[model samples]
Target: MGGAMAVRVAAAGHTLTVFNRTRAAAEAVATRCPVDVTVAGTAREAAAAADVVVVSLADDAAARATYGGSDGLVAGLAAGAVVADTSTVAPETTRALEADVRSAGGLLADTPVSGSVSSVEGGTVLVMAGGSAEAVERAAPALESFAQRIIHLGPLGSGATMKLAVNAMVFGLNQTLAEALVLAEKSGVARELAYEVIANSAVAAPFVHYKRAAFEHPESAPVAFALDLVAKDLDLATALATQVGAPVPQVELNRRIVGDAIAAGRGAEDLSALAEHLRG
Candidate 1:
C-alpha cells in the first residue's frame, strides 16, 4: 500500500524519500516512481525533512517502533509538519499517535485506505480520514491525487474504526462467496458458469465479482492479497469490535477460518484460496 501510494505521489510530480525495512524493496519502488526519489536509512530520516510524512507500515507495533521512541519520527519531525498514518491499526493507537504528534508540535491524521492493488495503482482508492477539519483540508489535495473518494469520517480515531467496519463486511462476504463457489463446483457446475450466474443475480456483490477470475481459474496466477495479511486484518477487525462492545460472532468464525487457512500453509497464497478450505 505504501509503495502504491508513493508511486502515485511521485507520478504526480512530488519528490519522495522512502524508507523500508528492506532497502532493496524501497529502491525498487523508488525506481518505478516518476519524481526525484531518495531511499532513507530509517523512518526518522524519512520523516525529518519532509513537509508531510506518511507512515504506511503493518500494525501498531511497527508504527510505534517507527515513531514512538527517541530515535523515531516523533523525535525528528519539524514543528507544523503533518504526520499522516495510512496503516490499518487500532483506533487507540491512532488517537495516541495524534496526541503524541501534537505534543511534539506536529499535526497528525489517521487516513486509512480501501480498495485493492489495482484500484490503488489506478488512483481510485477510497480514503477514510479522521482528524480536525483543518487538518483534513490541509491533506486533501495530496490525498485526492491518489483517492477517488476522500471522506472525513470524524475526529482522530474514526478513520480506523471505519476501516475495521469495512474489512469485517469484506471478510464476511468473501467467506460466503468462497463457500458458495466451492458448493457450485461440487455440484459439477463449471466455475465460470457459476460465477456468471451469481454475477447476474441479486446476490452478486463487488467482492464476488472481484474474486471471479481467481475462482474460475484457481491456479492461473499469483495471489495479489495473501492469506496471512487477510488473517491479520481480520484479527485487527475482531479486536476493534471487542473494543466497541460490538458482538461479531460471524466475524470471529471467519477469523478462525482464515487462521485455519494460514495454518495449513496457505499463508502466502491469495485469499481466494479459501475456496480450497470450503471444499474440504
Candidate 2:
C-alpha cells in the first residue's frame, strides 16, 4: 500500500522522498513512481525533505519505532510540517505520537485509509483524517494525491478510532461471508456460483466485490491482505472494545476464528482463506 501510494502521489505530479524499513523496498518504489522520487536513507531524512510527511507502517510498534529515536522522523521534521500517519494502530498510540510531533514544532494527524492496493493505485481510497483543522488541511494535498475521498473527523486519534470501528464491521462481514459460502458449498452450490450471487446480493460490499478472486480461487489469488494482519486488526478492535466497556460478542468470535486459522499455520494466507478453514 505504501508503494502504491508513492506511485499514485508521483502520478499526481508530486515529487516524493520515499523511505521504507528496507532501503531496497524504497528504491523499488522510487523506480515505479512516475515523478522524481528520492530514496531517503532514514525516516528523519525523509521527514526533513517534505512539508507533509506520510508514514505508513504495519502497526503501533512500527509507527512508534519510525517516529522515535535520535534519527527518527520526529528528530528531522521541518518546523510546522504536517505528518500524516496512515497506520492502523490504537488511538492511544496516535495521541501519544501527536504530542511528540507537536513538541517538535510539527502537527500530526492520524490518517488511516480504507480500500485495497488496486484502489490505492487507482487513486480511489478513502482517507479518514483526525487532527486540528489546520493540520488536516495541511495534510490534505498529500493525501488527496492518492485518496479520492478524504474526511476530516475531528481531533487527533479520531481516525484511528473510526478505523477500528470500520475494521470490526469488515472482519464480521468476512466471517459471515466465509460461513455463508461454506454452507452453500455443503448444500451443493458451486463455490464460484455462490460467490457470484453473494457479490450481487443485497449484502454485497466493496470488499466482497474486490475479494472475489481470493474467495473463489484462494490458491492463485494474491495475498492482498494476509490473515495474520486480519488477526492483528481484530486484536486491536477487540482491545478497543474492552477499553470502552463495549460488548462485542461477534467481533470476539471473529477474532477467535482468525486466531484458530493462524494457529493452524494459515496465518500467511489471504483473509478469504477463512472459507477453507471453515470448510474443514
Candidate 3:
C-alpha cells in the first residue's frame, strides 16, 4: 500500500522519500516511481527529512516498533510536522500514538483507507481520517492526491474505529458469501455459473465482482488481500466490539471461520480461498 501511494505521489509531481524494512524493496520502489523517489535509510531519517511523514505498516507491533524505537519516526519529526498512519489498528492504539506525536510537537492522524488495490492505484479509495480539523486540513493535499473521497471523522481514533467497523462488515459479508457459494455448488450448481450469477445479482457488492475470478477458482486466486491480514483485522474488530456494548454475533462467527481458513494453510492466499476451504 505504501509503495502504491509513493508511486502515485511521485506521478503527481511530488518529491517522495520512501523507507522499507528491507532496503532492496525500497530501492526497487524508487526505480519504479515515474518521478525520482529518494530512498531513506530508516524511518527516522525519512521523518527527519520531510514535513509530512506517512506510515502504513502491517500491524500494531510493527507500527509500534517503527514509531517507538530509539530512531523512530516520532523521535525525528520536526515541530508542527504532521505524521499520519494508515494502518487499521485498535482505536486506543491510535490515540496512544497520537499522544506520542503530539507530545513531540507533531500532529498525528489515523487515516485508514477502503478499496482494493485497483481502487488504490486509481486513486479512488475512500480515506477515513481522524484528528483535529486543523490536522486533517494539513494532510488534505497528500490524501487528496491518493483518495477520491476523504472523510474527516471527528477526533483521534475515530477513523480507526470506523475502519474496524467497515472491515467487520466487509469481511463478514465475504465469509457469508463464501458459505453461500459453497452451498450453491453442493446443491447441484456449477461454481463458475454461481459466481457469474452472484456477480451480476442485485445483492452483489463491488468487492464480489472484483473477486469473481478468485471466488470461482481459489487455487490460483491472486493475493490482492491475504487471508491472514483480513483475519487479523477481524480479530481487531471483534476486540473493539467486545469493548463497546455491541453484540456482533456474525462477526464472532466469521472470526472463527477465518481462523479455520488460516489454520488450513490458506493464510497467504486470497481471502476468496475461504470459499474453497468452506467447500472442503
User: Model 3 over residues 154-226: C-alpha lDDT tens digits?
Assistant: 9889999999999888897798789889999999999889888888888698788777877877766778888
After the best TM-score superposition of candidate 2, give how far the Cα of residue 73 lies from its true spot, in angstroms: 0.6
Which 10-residue window of candidate 2 scores lowest in summed lDDT?
A: 6-15
TM-score of 3: 0.96
Steric clash pairs (candidate 1): none
Model 2 TM-score (2 dp): 0.98
Which candidate has the top score in TM-score? Answer: 2
lDDT of each: 0.84, 0.91, 0.85
Tell me the spans in candidate 3 whose CA falls farther than 4 Å from its real position.
none
Q: Among these predicted structures, which one has the highest lDDT? A: 2
- Evaluated against the true structure, the overall lDDT of model 2 is 0.91
Cα lDDT tens digits, model 2, 156-200, are: 989999999998898889899999999999999999999989999
lDDT of 1 by residue, 44-90 (tens): 78878787887788788888888877768988888888877889888
Q: Candidate 1 at residue 242, lDDT?
A: 80
Colliding residue pairs in candidate 2: none
RMSD of each: 1.7, 1.0, 1.4
Score residue 232 of candidate 1 by CA lDDT: 81
The C-alpha TM-scores of every prediction are: 0.93, 0.98, 0.96
Looking at model 3, report the run of 10 residues with the lowest lDDT sum.
Answer: 213-222
